[model samples]
Every structure is written in structure tokens, then in C-alpha cells.
Target: MSLCEAEKTFILHGVEENFRIDGREREDYRPMEVEIGIISHAFGSARLRLANTDVLVAVKIEVDTPYPEKPSQGKLDFFVDCSANATPDFEGRGGEDLATGISNSLSDAYRSSKAFDLKKLCIMKGQKCWKLLVDILLLECGGNLYDAVSLAVKAALWNTRVPGVKSVGIDGKNVELNVSERLNDCVPLDVSGAPVMVTVCKIGEYCVVDPSAAEEKCSSAALVVAVSQGNITTVLQGSAGSLHPTTLMDSLGLGVEVANQLNIALMETLQSAPPHFDVGFLK
Candidate 1:
């Protein structure tokens, strides 16, 4: 990921000319591929590949008591694992820091009620609730990890189905519940307001979206912007660098615009996707 002076200069000149080394415009994203329902055991799963960046996400549900304060709402948790298969640098516990950072960012992005509704996951006022555990596995890393992870997580949640409750009864001091026996008797998660992240990288005086590995090395500063339903849910500054007030404002504008477009494209692709087949890394 290190770039020499000459390589950095080349990238800077290309950005100034509005053409990247990969032949992409400033706001253009690399080609993306998405697949859903890849994991049979999990309630829902999805895999996304943006160029060389690969991410897999799965959603698991467990019945548990709701928190005292938020008894009316369910729980959502994010976990990220950077597999060593992606890079030798991630072996052992080396990837823990990176994984924690990504998971924290996801939690912040989904914290707002406008971004995701936990009430739909609630089964009872205080006795019981469904806790969603979103697990993200990073299989490969080319660049733009934040954007790819967010998209994959959103897609997996969209594909998740919660089984319908057949009945809820109180027996003694315990709450009893029965779930539907039929496999098809389930409810799909609503993800219309799920946030999509866009990483804006600053090189020279220009800003670029979806930076490749080389582009990332040349960046002085970067911002990861999360947009949900045309509104910004979170803004995270990444790596080491400082930005002027005007430059930061401009980057925010660009990030929001790019994120909006990315969200639309992802939704269309998910809707038009055909019946699933075995198209994992083997493909």
C-alpha cells in the first residue's frame, strides 16, 4: 500500500485531469457484484465484491430478554472479522484493531431510529425480544473497506426473515412462546432506510470516491459518510490528516451525493437479482 513519490505524482496529476488510474471519474465506483442467501444455516446472508474488496455478512437471531430501559425495542449488534485469507497481516489477533473500528462505525451508523427500527424485532413489551447478531467477515481487501462492508451488511439484513410467533402465553412465572412451523411463514426485514457508506479520499486538491489501494496510499485525508434515506446518519474522518473548513464542507457534499447514488444502485440490483446459485469465492 506504499507509493513512491513518482507514483503519487502520477495519481495526483490524473486526479487533476478528472481521470483516475483505473479510468474512473471522481464520483464513479468500481464495478460491484452482490449475492444473497449464500449461508443456509444463518437466517440471512449476503456477499459483496467491489473490485478486489470482498465482504460476507450473515444475520442470526436469538430470543432474549429486552433491556430494562429499552424494553419496547429489540437489540442489534455488529461484529467484524478480518480473515487471514485476505492478507498475512491479519493473522492471529493482528486484525482486532481494524475489526473493532469497522464494527464501531457500523454501530454508530445504525444507532439512529431513522436508519434502522428495532421495534419491529420486539416480541413482547419486556419479557422477550429478538436480538439480531450481524456478523461480517472480510475475505479480501483491495480498498474502500467501509463502503463495501456497509453495503453487504445492509443487503444481508434485507434478506433476513424472522419466523412468525404462533402464540404467546404466560405459564406460572415464565413467558411461553411458539414459533411457526412452516418455513415460509416468516416476516422480511424492512431496510428502506438502511445507511450506505461512501468513502471520499482527498488527493492533491481533488476529492475521489471509492479509492483503489494505490489511490488510498496517495490520499492525505479521507472521510467515510453514511447516508440513510437521503439524510446523513454519521460522518467519520479516517486515517491521519487535517482538512480546512471549506474543504471539509465540500467533501461532505460530495460524499452525500455519491452515497445517495450508491444506495439507489444497490436497491435496484437487490430487487432485480435472480434466484440464488452457488456463486461464492469458488466462482
Candidate 2:
């Protein structure tokens, strides 16, 4: 949505005062709710609601040949789908560009060995491996989609349970594998190092985390920071506006600080959550 000059001024003034339109501090985030194992058909699934922004993530695993260049490692792919109803910008073909950008950002964030270890997904040397496809569906867009998507993706990966292989038989060039049918014979993914992203928006001279839709329009530029294990993984710039070196550094610092806090809170919620059926997905 386009903001008028008056609305922009109001948002800018609020940012300058370190208070947002939603009554959050500069570094404060919106309230969030997370539900795991939301998709019964998928191996792993999670739904996250950050204020008005909603995202659903599912992890689907398949047995496939490992890349020739990386024989010992498995493959991980990210795909983002934006529903037309999510936002006006998502209607028609406009959302494809945004979806592609978000997908690439997630891929970059998870490329590092410290971020996610693909070696654990390997089944048999170069012949057989587990390929994880992380599918993200955007159900709503209030703002800060990068952070919402990253959080949901991490939660989904944590909920994933990879089936165990009972036996692997090699017949020259052919490889035969038998996966365990028992539901209890499954291994959960290690997501301790998974990255979480935070969007720091530059409004006037100050910066704010988790900007609302109106606050986003009033900002000149924004930085998407992905942090893994308390370390910065990727920093992406948004909008055409340029930033001064000092501002860039400051934004990065803020992003890192908020990402660490977000990660801690998310882990605490996941660990303490009890087993329950997910009813949010249907809505």
C-alpha cells in the first residue's frame, strides 16, 4: 500500500522517537505464535504467525543421487509460493519476483557448513542420498516476510523426521535401499545451527526491527540479516535507497542482536510445547 506524505511523516516521527506505530520499541518484535507438524502428509511441517504475517513451511524428503561435485553431501532446495490473496502485490505475476528473491535468500543463508550440515542427509557415498525440499507458502503478508519465512522454515526443519534405512545393497552401478516402515524408527534433524533472519528498516535517521506495513513504506531502505548460532550468515539489502557506511554497520549490528534473541525465544517455545493437533492450517 502506498502511504501519503502525512502518513509517512507520522511513521518517521515515531521511528525517531524509538517508538513504532504498534507501540513497540526500535528493537522490539511483534508477538508470534508457532505450531509444529501442521501438515500431516508432509514429513515435517510448521506454521508461524507473526502478528498479521502468516507462513507455512513443509519439508519433503526423497532419495536421489548426490551431486557429482559434492558426492558426500546431500542436497537441499528452497521454494517459496506466494498466494494472490496474501497481498495486492502478489496478484498476477508480480509476486513471482518477490518469491524468487526470498527463495534465493534462504538458500544463501543455509549454504554455509555452520548454518546447516548436509552430510547427515547422505545415505550411501555418491550413489544414494536424501534430498530435502523446503516448501514455503505465504498465507498472509503484514510485513517483514523474510523474518517470518526464516522462522517458519527453521521450525519445520526441526520438526522433520527422516526415515531410517534398514539396508543398503550395491549391485555394481545399481544401489538398492530399504527404508524402515516403523514410525518410531526415524531420526530427527539437527537444527541447532539453523539460521533466523531479522529485517531492520531504516526510517529517517533511526532503524527499527519488525516494521509494520505502514512503517515499511516510510522507510528509505532495509537490511535482512540472517544469523546462525549467534553468527551472521547473510546480509541482504532491500529497496533502491542507499545507506551510508555507518548506517549499514549499525543496521547489521542491530540485526544480529535481534536475531539472537529471536532464536532463543523460538527454541524455548519449541522445546516446551506439548504434543497437539494443528488447527490453524485449515484457516
Candidate 3:
């Protein structure tokens, strides 16, 4: 967690007036900064900062044999690494559990066929296919990790450019093809169903969105809602304690409403990002 009980009350009161601790409204998202194509070695890369939490996502595309069961489809894997820079508690593999949890959650969120189409990445029937590895690096943990990570993933995907295929020459004994010409060409991935995770903290019977560390500690429990295109993708209950059924439902509804607005703001921001935008850090 990131503030104190008094600080939380101040934030809550600000929210009640449609203002936030950062001087934004409940509907207004924190100033988001994005940087694309930052990694020269990776196929695509992006860095996103939402208030304090900073997340970097890089896309690495590789060629591999398609899975036997899903030969016609490609694969998109998600991996989250919790860097020790965020906190000392994550030192020496101590953060493995949390890292794995975040990665697995992302895999589940994108596993549905309807969420992300993989067939477009298939090159051969069962021989070769493109696999996209999405690696997420956590730079800071000032709170609101879920929202920040999801936004970074979406931006990285948008910046991704899959290498195009030149030609396919298959022989009975050995199959050899020429692909050098198409190495420079690339196609962008469609991320329309990119899901956003919204956390609704239940603090003294009131729900708070995007809580800071202190606000998180002040709350009894929280609900994690993954929403894609205004639809509920997944719902997870967090915090150290449990909650009443009615409160859970209320949190979910609030999350959905906030998620829709968040998605819209993200889309607008990405669209407005300039081609040669600068990375804003130390901010």
C-alpha cells in the first residue's frame, strides 16, 4: 500500500466532490505517460505510467511449431516479473509467488478465443506459427498495479509489428522458404478486447477506485474486476478479509462502470500519442 487514515479520509472527501488526491475527478484518470519503441532488441515495447505505478511491456515474436490441438492457431503468452526495485520484500525470489499469480491471471484473462484471435498469426497448418511473448516489467509499486499493467499491455500490443512472411516453399525431404524480404514488413495486432482490471476498495462501507497504499490499508477488503469492452471478463475478491454478498455485487457494478470509462480514456490517449513522443520519468 501508498497513504494514512486521515489521508484516506481526505481522499474520500475529495472523491465525494468528484475530485481526487491528485486533483483529478473520480472519472478523470491520472496523467498517463507512454513511450513506444523503447527497446531496440524487442519486436515492440512500451512503457506506461499511471500516477505512481510504472509498467513496461515488451513484445517478442518468435517462430515455433503450433500446438497439436490448436495447430491452426498461434500463441500469445503473458509473463509478469516483479522487480526488486519496487520493494525489498521482493528480493531473492521472494516475489516469485506474486509474479506467478499476476502472470497466471493474465493468461486466464486472454485464454478465451473470443478475447484475442490467434488464428491470424498461423503461418502453416501444423508446422510453423508465430508466438507472441508479452513480458511485463514492474518498475514501481505505488499502488494501482492492475490498471497500470493492463494499460501497458494494451499499448505494447498496439505498438507491436509482426514480421511478414515472404514465401513458402515446401519440399518432401526438407522444407525451405525465403523470408528475408518480408523481415522489414510488419502487421499490428488487434487489441480490441484488451481487458482492464479495476479495483474497488471497500473502505468504511464506501467503494474507492484506484486507491493508494494508505487507502488500501484503510480498507477492509477489495474487489478486482476485469472488464473488456464494458463486459465482465473476470471478478476476483482481494484483501485480507471477506465481504458480504451485497457489497461484493455493488463493488462489481461500480468496477464495471469505472472500467468502461477507463477504456475510453485509454483509447483516446493512445490515439493521440505522437509518433516521436518523449518518455516522461522522474515525475
Candidate 4:
């Protein structure tokens, strides 16, 4: 399945002309499909398919005591699962390491105060706080996992609806949950400043955004940047081999530019999306 030297040169030549192998311009985004509330079991859910990369996000909430250090803030946790459905290499526990890596990276990307407002999720100062468990499922790894996962996270957060509470009663150190008469009423989470991740792959002497699987194999290095309203939330450098500092910086610059465009397109799609939209994989 590997490309020959001639085919590789053809790809490079196409990039030099500002047109890619798939006839896409540098700023053009691949066709994407998004679905919300797909999983009835989860409180909030979203499934996004970016070209070939498929991602599923689920949000679960629980009531728990706030942390001692941050009693006024709630919690938002990220957990990534690399399912075997994506590839045979991830069968059993073999993909645990990669799953942990993705989850930890997301934690670093979204834990900052500027990325998400956790205080808004707090109910009581030190007594009760809402803990959000954001779980991500990697159904397919076509090329860009970071970008796909971030998009899914934003979509899931948009679909999240927290139940409204009327009051909290405490008696004999036991807390009672009193919800409003409108049990079906829910409030949506704010996601204006949510971070969007972009990956820039360095191939030959040029950098490319949203590289294909074959292109990724030929790349010497890559940079992943999570941008929240033009601010950098997370910076990650990955490569099959080593890279120089100059090249790394150059790649990061390219990543930032690509990230901005990605955010704009995602927002546009979400704004015009309909409630009963159909998102099929075969599409």
C-alpha cells in the first residue's frame, strides 16, 4: 500500500501548485458530517466524521464534593478510548498507551481557565459540584485524530443540556436534591471559547494541513496546536523521526494558520445545521 518515489514526487508537485492530490486547495476543508444526540443512553453525545477520521463523544455528569484546592469550581475530565474497530493493532489492551496519551493531551489542552469555565458548573461552594466526564471513542484513524477529536468535543459540549435545580436541602449532613417542576427543561453549556486542534504535517520541505494516511507516513515531523479563539491552548510536536528547532517553529506557524480556518468552518457548519439532519457514513 506504500507509494513509489514517482507517486510521492507527484504529490509534492501538486502541493507546490497550491492544489493537493485530492484537488483541494490549501485552505479548503474536507467534507465533514456531524450528528448530535446519537446515543440515547448518554446525557450528551455527538458523532463527527471528518473525511475518513471518525470520532464519537459522550458527556456524563455526576454530583460530587468539590476539590479542596478549588472548592468553587467543578470538574471536567477527558477520557479517550482507542477501539479495535479502527484497526487490528489496537485489539485488547494494546491501544491503552495511545488512549492514555490522547486523553492526557486533551486534559492539557482544555484544563486552562481560558479554555473552559468550570466555575459555572459549580452548584455549591464546597458541598456540591457537577463533575463532567467527557469520553471520546476513536472509531477510525484515517489521518488527523487530533482535529477530529477536538471537533467532536465541541459538538458534544454544544449538545450538553444540564438539568435545572430548584434548591438543595441539607439535613443531618445528608444533602437532598430538589429539581424544578420542569424535569425536562435543561440548559446548554457555553462553548464559545472551546479549543480547536489542528495538525500540520511536514512533508519534504513543505508543511501541509489535514494530511492523508500516506502523506503522514512520508512526513518527517508534525505539530499539533489547539487554538481557543486565536489563543494557543496546547502545543504538541510529533514525528516518526527527529526534527530541527527551526523546522518545528515553522511547522507550528503553519499549524496556527490552519487552525483559524478550521474553527471558522466548524462554527459556520454548526450554525446552519438542522435538528433532523441525517449523517450517514456512506455519504
Between prediction 2 and prediction 3, which has the larger TM-score?
2
Q: Tens-digit lDDT track for model 3 on 1-283?
A: 4556678787667656765667654444556688887888888888988777888999999887889999999998998998998867678997788778677767766776666788988988788889999999998877777777877887788778888778877898455555554645778788888888888887665677887755666778887888887778777666777889898888888898988887777677667775336544223
The most accurate candidate by TM-score is 2
Q: Write the per-residue lDDT of candidate 2 for residues 1-283, one digit (tens) a residue.
A: 9988999998888888887788888888888888899788899999999889999999999999999999989999999999999999988997999999999999999999899999999998888999999999999999999999999999999899999999999888889999998989999999999999999889999888988888888889899999999899998887778889999999998888888888888887787775343423111
On residues 142-170, what C-alpha lDDT tens digit does candidate 1 reach at each position? 99999999999988998899989999999
RMSD (Cα, Å) for all candidates, in order, is 2.5, 2.6, 3.1, 2.7
Q: Candidate 1 regions off by >4 Å?
A: 275-283
Worst 10 residues of 4 by lDDT: 274-283
Pick by lDDT: 2 or 3, better one: 2
Per residue, candidate 4 scores C-alpha lDDT tens digits across 1-283 of: 3779998888877777778888876545677788987888777889999887899999998888899999999999999989898867688897798788778878888888888999988888888888889999999878878888998898888878787778889997888878654637677788888888888877777778878776776777777888887888888775666667897777677777777777777667666665436443212
Off by over 4 Å in 2: 277-283
Q: How far is candidate 2 from the true structure (C-alpha RMSD, Å)?
A: 2.6
Greater-lDDT candidate between 2 and 4:
2
Alpha carbon lDDT of each predicted model:
0.89, 0.89, 0.77, 0.80
- The list of candidate 3 runs beyond 4 A from truth reads 1-28, 173-177, 180-184, 276-283
